[model samples]
Target: MGATRSHRIPRRAAHPALAAAIAAAALALTTACDPVGGLNSAAVAVTTDQVATAALQHQHVDIKWLTCTAHLDNGPRATPSAGSATKDVADVTCDGETKDGRPITVRGTVTQEVEGRCVKGDLTAKVADRTVFRASVLGDCTAPAPTTTRVTPAPGGHPTVTVTVTVTQSFQGK
Candidate 1:
């Protein structure tokens, strides 16, 4: 019989690290796909949609549109249903920081639409004569059509590639 020596696995195995990295990457991809839940390279959940949701809710619509046409600062805005009333676009603002310590702010209304009380199938979320929300604005107010927008955060020190979200929204009573 030959003498046998005890063997033990290494405390830090490359396999485990690799697995964790892969899992993190996979999660990042998933969150990145959504308007919110962005990883921001450092697992930072920061974005326009997230900010808007925090500031407002039950008033979100997948509002998507193009802005600053010449500069192409495309934005997002959701379509509201007919006879639906939008909660007044809150003249609210929020402050937050990215994963990299970069401060960001969302200066807009929380986009959304809801249907319930339809007095002659007409509703509006106008402020000071500004058509921020309206029932049947799209001509069809039977179904709720979510919207989207694109927003890119300011620079984060290094040359980091920015992901522009096409829209930001939050809905209530639906």
Candidate 2:
């Protein structure tokens, strides 16, 4: 009998170099499709005022204070030489009104994680240690009454108040 002959095609593995090239090409294509600057984009730095505004908004409760007053233990410190500087810790009290002009008073503590204008995790806000403080848009945090003795003391090496205006809208500044 004649010798039987069998023919079969051998399978070959993909080249490592070819696989790597394909992967690199795919990555490049994905990155090129990005319109806005991705990782390479530079973020604009915000001011301390901006961050403070955000922290205030974090309270979630609105206090119409545009005409009221505020005292911060470590809020915004005014310097006789230059401008004011934001503090790291603060005990703040804002006496103002609500949107409807009801009187309201809000107190809280704000802390700046870092000494910068950034306020992501660096900014923290906590309401005053109280159950519920009366707030309104038609009146001040407290009803107007006669004063016994006037007292105004500095926060003791803390920022006092830079803005007396109550903030309703979010901080929309750069």
Candidate 3:
């Protein structure tokens, strides 16, 4: 019987610099794909506007010329409970006029989830001195983002003012 010989293939170790570069690339890809982690104050502001408008429309209010602004509350003072994920809370305020020429206002705080769609919050809508709508929205709490129109004055000495308006379609929901 002839002798059988086995040939072993040696494995090469990855260089330290290559490993570090791979790690950095992985981290960058992860951060870029993570919607929750990439949410900034400007994005939160837009989300807040959508949420507030949805809340108002849910109450059958025909909102016009709505202007919304948001402030993020993820500062050092914000602390989540143990075992709970850190949440980004945005304080939102919207002001506009109703179809009937009455002033409408929405005040609330909203939180957007990681799915890039789910938004939950507590909102209150008031027409003049009467509170028309108030609730803790669980899901489907987003509307179309508002649009801004910049009106530039003519070559005269007039000033330029930027205006943002959100006009929601009339909703017939009780």
- TM-score-best of 1 and 2: 2
| lDDT by residue for model 1 (36-80), tens | 311122111122223232222234322222111001111343356
RMSD (CA, Å), candidate 2 to true, equals 29.8
Q: Please identify model 3 stretches exceeding 4 Å from their true place.
A: 1-39, 77-85, 113-118, 138-174
lDDT of 1 at 160: 29
lDDT of 2 at 135: 23
lDDT of 2: 0.28
Per-candidate clashes, comma-separated? 30, 18, 0
Computed on alpha carbons, the lDDT of every model, listed in order, comes to 0.26, 0.28, 0.47
Query: Can you give the TM-score per candidate against the true fold?
Result: 0.19, 0.24, 0.49
**What is candidate 3's lDDT per residue for 48-133, written digit by digit as tens?**
44445556667776655466555557644333555445666767666777667798777886665322223456777788889987
Between the candidate structures 1 and 3, which one is better when assessed by TM-score? 3
Point to the candidate with the largest lDDT. 3
Please report, as a residue range, the 10-residue window in candidate 1 with the lowest summed lDDT. Answer: 65-74
The TM-score of candidate 2 is 0.24
The residue ranges of model 1 lying beyond 4 angstroms of the native Cα positions read 1-45, 53-57, 60-62, 65-105, 108-157, 165-174
Ranking by TM-score, best first?
A: 3, 2, 1
